[model samples]
Target: MKVDIMKKRRTVLNGKPFSIVDDLTKMDLTERKKWAPQVKQLYDSGTRLRFSGGKWRDSAGKSYIFVFNLTLDKKGGVQKTNFNALDACLSYLDKFSLDDVWRTRNPLSSGFTWTSNIDNIRCRLDFFLISKKLVNKVNDCYFQPPLQSDHHIVILHCDISIEPRGPGYWKFNNSLLLDPAYIDLVNSLISNYSSDPHNSNQNPASFWEGLKFTIRNNTIRFSKLKANDSHIYEKNLIKKIAQLESDSISDENLLRELKDARSNLHLLYKNKLEGIMIRSKARWVEEGEQNSKYFLSLEKRNK
Candidate 1:
C-alpha cells in the first residue's frame, strides 16, 4: 500500500515570535476514510505539536498560527462532514490546547470560503487555528472575493505588535554562483589579488584573510547592484500586472495577458523562495556538522 504524508510550510518572520504554517495537505476532510489517517499522522508529528508553551511563544504567549484550507465547516452548519473526522479534529485540537480563531472570536459570523461554479455551491472550508492563549489578540476575521481561484482569501487581523529588528549580518548569496558575469568578476578579482606584489610580504594566513575580505567587499557591491535591478524589474512587473487587471475588467480580451503577468510574478516569488530554502538548508547543514553554539541553543530550547 502506498501512503502519502501531509506536508506543511512553516514560516517564521524576523522579529516575530509566532510561526505561520500554511497547509499543503490537499486532502478534503469530508472524505473521512481517505484523509483521517493522514490527518492523524499530521497531528501526531512531534515538530508541529512540540512548540506549545515552549520557547517559541512570545511575550503574549502566542507560539504559532495555522492557516489552512481544512475543507470542513465548523460554523456554516450546512456543509456535511463525517462525524468521525470532525470528532478526530476537535479532539486533537482540545488535546493540543488549540483554538479556532474565527469560531471563538466571531461566533455569529457567516462567510463562504469556497464556491463551485458548476453548481453554484458555497462552503466555508478555510480556517485559522492558533494557541488558545492568543485568542484575545485576534482583532478581526473576514473573507475576501476570490482572485483567480474558487476559494476566497481568509484574512485574520491580529492586534499583536511587530518588534522592530536591526539589520543583521550579511551572508553570501548562493544564487550568484549561477551567474556567469559574477563568476567572471570573481575570477578577475582573484587574478588581480594573486598578481598584486604589495601583499607579497604578508604571512600566508594574513594573505588568505585579506583575499577573503576583498572578495567579500566586492561580492557585497555586486549583490547590491543586482538587488537594485531586481527591485526595479519587480516593480515594473507589478505595475504592468495592475494595468492589465484594470483593462481586463472592461475588456475580457486582456484576461490572458493579466494571467501571464500574474504567472510571471508568481514565478519570481517562487524562485526567490527557492533561493531562500537553499541558503537555509546550506546553513543548517554547515551549523549542524559543527555543532555550533547557535544550533546547540536552538536544539536545547526546542527540546
Candidate 2:
C-alpha cells in the first residue's frame, strides 16, 4: 500500500514554539465551522493561527521563534488572498518581536531560492525568521547549491561560545609533489641554500635540519595558497554550473558547457575523495589492531 501525503498548503516549523495547521481552504464547510471557535480563541489570545500550539523559551528566560522554509514570493514577501491570514501573521510577528534574518542582513539583496523551468518561475521562497534577541548571534546567512532539488539550500551560521583549544599538528599534502612547478621551486630553494656561504658555515646535521625547515615552511605556504585558489575556483564552477543548468533549457550551447562543467566538478570531487581515502587508509594501517580475523575481514570488505 502507498500512502500519499500532501505537503502543499501547510507550514513546517523547526522549533518548539510553533504548531502545524492545515490550510483553511482544504477544510470542508462543516470542518471550518467546527474549528471556528478554536481559531477565534487563538486569535483572541494573540496567538498566530498557524503557530497556535506552544511557546519556546530558553533557560535564560529568553523566548525564541523559528520560521523555516516559508512559502513566499521572490522578494521574500508573504502572499495570501485572505487579509485576516496576513494580519494574523504580521500581528503575531509584531507581538513576539521577531525579525527576518536575511532581510535584516541583506536588505538590498535579490535572488531566488527556488525555480521551476516548466512554469518559468523563479522566486526566493525559503527564509528564516528568528527572535530579535538572537539577531546579534547570527554570524551569516546565505544560499548554497541544492542537490536533487529545484530549491537552493539556505544556510545560517550562528556564533556560539565554546572552550578554545590549541592548534593541532599540520600534515603536508603529498598531492603538492604532483605539481611540476612546486617541485622546481623546491629544488631551486635547496640549491640556493646549499650554495649560500652562510648556510655552508653550518655543520652537516645543522645544515640538513635548516634545509628541512626551509622546505617545510615553503611547502606549507604553497599548500595554503593552492587550497585557497582551489576553493575559489570550485565556488565559481558551482555557481556557473547552477546558472547554466537554469538557462540551458532555452539554449543548446549552454547545455554543452553545463556537461563540461559537471565533468570538471566530478573530477575534482573524485580526486579529493581519493586523497581522503588514502589518508584514512594510512591512518588505519598505523593504528589498526593486529592479526585479528575480524579486522582483516573488515579491511577486505572496505577494499
Candidate 3:
C-alpha cells in the first residue's frame, strides 16, 4: 500500500466550503448540534475524518473538528465529560454507517492512541471514520510507531492490485574471472573434467557438451556458496561493530575487519549495478558515471 500525508486548509475539507472550528473539545452541546449537519454532509461526500484532539481555527471561522480523548491513562476508561462528547460525535457518525475501522473489525476492544500519566483513563485520542463503501475496500488495519510524533502511526492495507512486473532477464557476471578465487575454482573444475575417465571415449561434440555441462554445474555451485558467505560475512561484521560500540570499547582489529568487509560488500554492489546497466542496454552510462544522477534516472526510465 502507498502511504503519504495529505495537508490541506481547514477552510475547505473534502472540497467543500466548511467552517474551520477545530476545537471540538471546547464546543458546547449547542455548537456540536449546529455542526452535525455539516459533518454528515462531508461524510456523505467520501471525506474520511481523522480526529486529532488538537484544535485550530481556519479562514472560514470554523473550528477544527478534533474531538477525542487525548488524556487517557491505562485501563480503557475516560472522564465523564470527555466520554459524553465522544458519544455525541460517534452517534452522529454511526447514523450514517460510518464506524471506526479498528473497532468495527474487533467489536469487544477499545482503540489505542497517545497516553498520559493522568487519572489512568484509557481512551483512543486518535481515530478515523470511513464510509461503508470505503470500509469494504479495506483489507487490514494496524499501527506503527511514528518516527517523530508522540502518536502511533495508523496504516491501512487495502485490496488494491499492484502493477505487474515484466519477466526478468538473467546475465552471467563475466567479471567473476577478475577474482583469484574464482579463477582458481574454474581451473580446478577444468582439471577435474580432463582427468575423468568416463569421457575418454566420447566423440568431439559429446566431449565438448559434457565439458560445458560440468562447467555450468560447478559455476552454479560456487555461485551459491559465495552468495551465502558474502551475506553472512557482512552481517557478522556489522554485528561485531555494533557490539563493540555499545560496550563503549574500541578495537583496532575489529575495525580493520569491518573496513575490509565493507570494501568487499561494495564490490558486490558495484557488480550488481553494472549487471543492471548492461541488461538495460544503456550505452550512455559511461565508466565512472554509473553513480551519476543522469545514469540513475535513465536506468529507471529504461527499466
Off by over 4 Å in 2: 1-100, 103-110, 116-126, 147-151, 161-167, 239-249, 276-303
For residues 159-262, write the lDDT of model 1, one tens digit per residue.
Answer: 76576778657777878999999999999998999889977678999999999999999999999999899888777776675344322143455656666766
Better of 1 and 2 by lDDT: 2
| Candidate 3 Cα lDDT to native | 0.53
Q: Return the TM-score for candidate 1, rounded to 2 decimals.
A: 0.41
Q: Which residue pairs overlap in candidate 3's backbone?
A: 19-62, 20-62, 20-63, 21-62, 21-63, 21-64, 22-63, 22-64, 73-121
Question: Taking the tens digit of each residue's C-alpha lDDT, what string does model 3 give over 204-279?
Answer: 8998899888877777777778879877875565445334322322467865664565466556556666766665
The best candidate by TM-score is: 2
lDDT of 2 by residue, 1-303 (tens): 000122123322223222223333234455556664654554355332232211223333333332322343332234323444435545656865656677688766555666665555556655665667667877998766554466676777766555567865667778888999899989999999999999999999999999999999999898888889989988898888767644425666775776678678766765655565554453454343233334445544554
Q: In model 1, which regions exceed 4 Å deviation?
A: 1-167, 249-256, 282-303
lDDT of each: 0.55, 0.58, 0.53
User: Residue 287 lDDT in model 3?
Assistant: 56
**How close to the true structure is residue 239 of candidate 3, measured as C-alpha lDDT?**
49
Weakest 10 consecutive residues of candidate 2 by summed lDDT: 1-10
